[model samples]
Target: MEGTMSESSAPRFRVLMFPWLAHGHISPYLELSKRLSENNFHICFCSTEINLNFIKKSKTFDEISSIELVQLDLPDLPELPPQHHTTRNLPLHLKSTLERAFYMGKANFQNILSTLKPDLLIYDAPQSWISELAALNHIPSVLFIIVAAVNLSFFYHAVNCGIDGTNEAYPFPAIYYRDYETKKMIAMSQESKESLPEDAAFSPKCFELSSFVLVKSWREIEGKYIDHFSFSCGKKVLALNLLNVQDDDTKEEENNSHIMKFLNGKDESSVIYLSFGSEYYLSKEEREEIAHGLELSNANFIWVLRFPVGDSIALEEALPEGFLERVKERGIVVDGWAPQAKILEHPSTGGFLSHCGWGSVTESMYFGVPLLALPMFYDQFLQARLAEDIGVGIEILRGENGQTNREEVAKAIKMVALENEVGELLREKARELSNQMRGGGEGVLHEAIKKLKDLCSKNK
Candidate 1:
């Protein structure tokens, strides 16, 4: 359903996209931009230098020459190192410092916007001020949510119901529901305590301010929640899938020969790929528990462990004692990064043990790998629910006080990765749903582009 207009018929318009510093947000925005560029649209992708470092080196970076990756200079804070330009490794409190740095770039950003004068602006949830800037310049804005619709619906419902903290009628279960958004609510309360007008809605006014809201999901995956969000937001809500799936046919896999050989040696559907998301390094106790779970499951695995940048990656100390020697024959523990998409498509990869970040979920499901989800925080818990509801995944249970025990982690792996009736059923359902992602309707993404064009046409 992808169509390329001839030279004479191509539309001429400029779009400026500003995603949050997180990898979860920046990745989807780039995917959408790549889609837009095929229609002859000019794109301005803005992020800090630290955010762009990894992106600039990616293979996809070469695929899209049309996108101008602009690196905005965040204000220099004494507490932060020049290399530490993002919030990836910083403490939770220092996250506020990253926000302050973003606010400091407003003047520079406005100047860039004035010069570019893009027809439309696309932004993320936390930085809704970009929408206000678009309004000031008389350009339409789109709130492109990187998270799932269920999360957004919960946020809108919470604000409307005046349940900022906890109330009896809260939507999710009592334990997770109470802990799900407590930190976010506390942050919102703290922001309120600071100097601000009584009329300020919240930190992220994405729902309240934008003309259009776009989510990286579809009606098939989350129909009822999508409808609920549309009704609550009172704006045009579009749930179109925009994942730029990397294919194995590409020669990129050849670059990582050691990994390819490891996966190639394993039997078909024998190995589980395990990774926590980019953010949130695993605690020592948590890491040891996961290591034990892998040992207990007796399944072949390639566990990708992410440590802090510039830290020495000593596998012996980080993992349990004798863990490397114990599982060396059947398991391989990779440090830092790996080619995720390539490994997921390998025939050996049967399931994914993940942090349930939406981006990772989209990739895992699209490639037909059943999920063993261990959701940590933010929108991840809600994302894990999507997998459970679809019956293609099983959640790793935590304790009453939110402790992830070794036994529960082992059980989840046994259910999904090991050969059993339950594992086969989950894997079969996963393959079926994977096709649903692509073939329900061919023109879904094409239609989304048309709508964006129509919005831009109005401005001209």
Candidate 2:
């Protein structure tokens, strides 16, 4: 649906969307743009050329006529070339450099805003300067958070109280991090602090600058966390229901015959689909343990493996010896990418062995696939805990040092995928939640659209 003129035949409100330079961030922003466009809002979707090129290739991009892809060019740095502008397959060491490059594109972004003169700006956090720029142009800005509200609320709590030596405990008991994870979190925080400018505005300050905030989640699953975050930030938080559920069967059929064929041969509710998202890659030990665990579980499975850019390590080198031969009939290992949504929607896929990225968690829930959660890092641990807390998934606990063993992984797979009382209960709960989510988001989305329009009108 394309946006139409108002009853008075006035021009549709124009929104400029600026997401951070990561696939995860860009994807949610694109989905939100689609929603806004359908509500009679013209959207100027801005990103680096590489990222925009990627969006142009997507099947969904062809269907949206109301959105215009605008390119925001970063300064030409020899180390950070055009291809490296996006975070897809980015080298770990160059991450900070990429951020610096993104920050340097402020002048170019300002030019875009000036040329487009959008009535509103919808942007991601950590780019708090955007709200200020939008205000200078007499436009309202809304910060769109792509992660789970539970994860954001936890950070807000920690930052408000000190990370260490806090007198008050985090409000949610179920979402505490392990010792190793806590240490890693602190280290990451310090690293980010050092990399950016002293006055760089993070989430807390970004929340203050926005007219309102939007999270890519619904109240059905995260009401408490969303309420907590809204109260703490003093911003009206609107929830955008699960935004990435692709319904494009035509594209799936054209690209995924081999994978669909493999899944078609499997029994109903018998195959486990494993993936750790696009950005994260497993260590050698982690790969061996997961491979051995799949062997031990004796469950049919499909696992997607990814390697960092320019890394040429073969599958045999990455996995345990003879692992492929051992599971030839029962398993398929895809390198780089797969049709994740299609696989989850398949009747044969009963469980998802995942790193529990928020996107993956929502997709699994939408398809009523029980989660075999093995959260690896950052907000993933919190998302994994939320999945378990809701009784739609079970976590594969690691040691105090955050080491995963084959036994735990196998146990989690069997408990979630095999025919048993626990698995049955989880499946039922997943279906219930899916039903609630599918049935209830239209009202919330309409309410959010009204709020956005009100903001635009006030500024006009």
Q: Which stretches of candidate 2 lie over 4 Å from their true place?
A: 1-8, 199-201, 246-255
- Listed per candidate, the RMSD to the true structure in angstroms reads 3.6, 2.6
TM-score of each: 0.89, 0.94
Worst 10 residues of 2 by lDDT: 1-10
Alpha-carbon local distance difference test for all models: 0.77, 0.84
Q: Model 2: how far is 391 from its true place, Å?
A: 0.8
lDDT of candidate 1 over 1-460, digit per residue (tens): 1256564476678888888888777778888887788777888988889878867775566677588888878788897665666767655555656666676677788887888888888888365566777788898888888788888877777777755534534354411343534665556567644633322324436556677688989677777778878887887788878775532334544555678799999988888899987777888889988999888888899998988766645999899999999998888888766789988989889899999888888888888899998887778877887788878888888877667789998888888777678988988988987888867543766777787887888888
Candidate 2 contains a number of clashing pairs equal to 0
Q: What shift in Å separates residue 406 of candidate 1 from its native position after superposition?
A: 0.5
- What is the Cα root-mean-square deviation between model 1 and the actual structure? 3.6
